[model samples]
Target: MKQLFVLATALLLAVSCSQNKAPKTLVLYYSQTNTTKAVAEEIANALGADLEAILPVVPYDGDMGATAARCAKDAAEGKLPELKPFTVDVAAYDVIFLGYPIWMGTYAPPVAAALEAVNLDGKKVVPFCTFGSGGLDTSVKDLQAKLPNTEILPGYGVRTARIDAAKAEVDYFLKSNGFLAGEVTPLPDFSEVRPATEADAAIFDAAVGTYPMIHAAATEVASRAVPGGIEYLFTAKDLPRDPAVEIPDHFIKVYVLAEDGKEPVFTQVLR
Candidate 1:
């Protein structure tokens, strides 16, 4: 009887241990100018996960133009900067939250280096980024191509101009995605796309006109109601602008948020 009792207790303990084992998460990021670092730290804190920075052996610390030039040159030469040895055993973690700032419409070169050095096979990777305009979709595509074995989960991104909104957005994002323990009222679907009215065009212009990189004319718009205001999705044609500032894409979609009693500002641009 005593032996049977001991076996039952062992089984109970095993069940308890299995129930308590949480999936481990690590936030690995490479940040230039600290925008992406802030987002990484926020996710790490909110999730209570481990955080580590991916560093390049030769830093890109030059002025904006010089750094961009260097990045272009290195990319053209098919060179990836050497990465510092990662202290964390990546295989030990079940999930990796990869973060970086968008440069040249994709993940920074240092992050590219890190991906080459670390093998995250079969792990769930959540990408989070900070960008000047938008590169989340493009970088995620690149990541999918690079790490075909890893499960690439849907990611979160915040514009550099709207970094202040990231805290609340991240919280909502975590809860909405089932990453955190909370209830979120899911946002309603956007209204169907229709021709942009004069007023809609005005809002679109107000939102994106000041931005130097984007020279677009809104052709169609769709709106949805949010807690504080209306969110617009604009299907825009790439305006004929100076070839210097134009991107190769002909059509782009822009998301604009017009909060109550505030001016409209663009959130993200999808090309």
Candidate 2:
């Protein structure tokens, strides 16, 4: 019965190999000013996942005003900028960490193009974003709506002001989500933030009617600086809050170009 024994041993080895195969993961992202890229790198390193950046065929201008104007036009028109050739076997990866900087309450346009390029019908999608005062909940919902066939995990967001503590935040997120087995680190705290001042109100007022996306009148609540611009967080005075939602102070972020001589031309509006 030596042949029978050999066959059984081979079958057991095959089963063991199948069971022990490492889960393949990919970290795909599009970063405008390296903020999202930094977060993506941290997640990729923690999970030992392959990393890929989505590059647009035409590089955006370094001037914050110019880039903002272009992005606004493209986004309004539903035009996806042509992307540089990025080939990834999407089906091979069991998990994909999709990252982007928040643009107008949604993921960047390049992210939209990337998601449309691949068929992730059965894969797990974990979305993460970099923002000023904006939260990740809205963007995660947008992604879920776009790829309803895929499973989306709870996402993570990092404010540019808190980039120094991203590793800790990412660690906590990973451990909490059962993606890692290790000691959890404390999440970043921004509770000591000061209230918005009259200067902040003036900035919002100056750019009120500049962009189509931003409401004509708003009450400035907070503000923060991103890489290429400053985001003025505000709440519409006319809009009623949904009592069903727990977040009472939910604010929208209006991005303005950071360069001098710019009349605070509004670029992006994000919730």
Candidate 3:
């Protein structure tokens, strides 16, 4: 009789503990041009999570060229911008949704400095970012390396040009990751790659032509159907800007979305 009572009490306590606790989430981000801030706010609103921005002691302002030069000088000196001290108790959060804008190829200097200041050990980290082209995968890898004990999950990234898509995309991202309650259709896999046809090349040209950084031509392509239309995965060969330079040509993977009744756009590029 005593054993039965003890077992019942233990089970009751276990049930109470399990049912009463919810993981606390915080949306922490640093935005240069407010693009990342928009994403951070959307996430916080959706999750009802705490929101905070990581600010640098010296704000990165001025023209793009000037900012780039300053960043470069800092990088060459191995210097990280001093971050303004965080007001929130970072240790209290169970899950941190870390967001940033990609600078050169990873999280901007302020984020790098924030990582140095905050100890995120044993916490679950979800990465999100805005970029000119693409850098989420690389930044996530960097975070994993820096915080070996932290659980880094799959991340969401959007191009600066596609900031307008963040709302619908963030909703889908949260739902798909089980962070929010909703149903999302799983995206289909791309079909096997084949040589690009004239139409495929035309679509690729129209998508990448505006980007000053890309001077490549599509060689092969594969595609799958998305919700609104189709998504293409193009294997492109970089065209030499200077024939006399004698640099070896390499391949890059580009993702382009052809939505219904709209011009196709390159969603992300994997170099």
**Candidate with maximal lDDT:** 3
Better of 1 and 3 by TM-score: 3
Which ranges of candidate 1 are over 4 A from the true structure?
1-16, 242-249
Give per-residue CA lDDT, model 2, range 209-248, as digits (tens): 4343443345545455543445554544433344464543
Clashing residue pairs for model 2: 105-270
> Once superposed on the true structure, which residue ranges of model 3 sit more than 4 Å away at CA?
2-7, 243-245
TM-score for predicted model 3 compared with the true structure: 0.95
Write the residue-wise lDDT of candidate 1 on 1-271 in tens digits.
9999999999999999999999999999999799999999999999999999998888888977998999888889999888888889887999999999988899988999999888899999999999989999999999999999999999999999999999999999889988899999999999999999999999999999679888888999999999999999999988767766756658899999999999999999997
Off by over 4 Å in 2: 1-4, 185-271
Clashes of 3: 0
lDDT (tens digit, per residue) of candidate 3 on 10-95: 99999999998999999999998999999999999999999999998889987778878999999899998988888899999999
Candidate 1, overall lDDT? 0.92
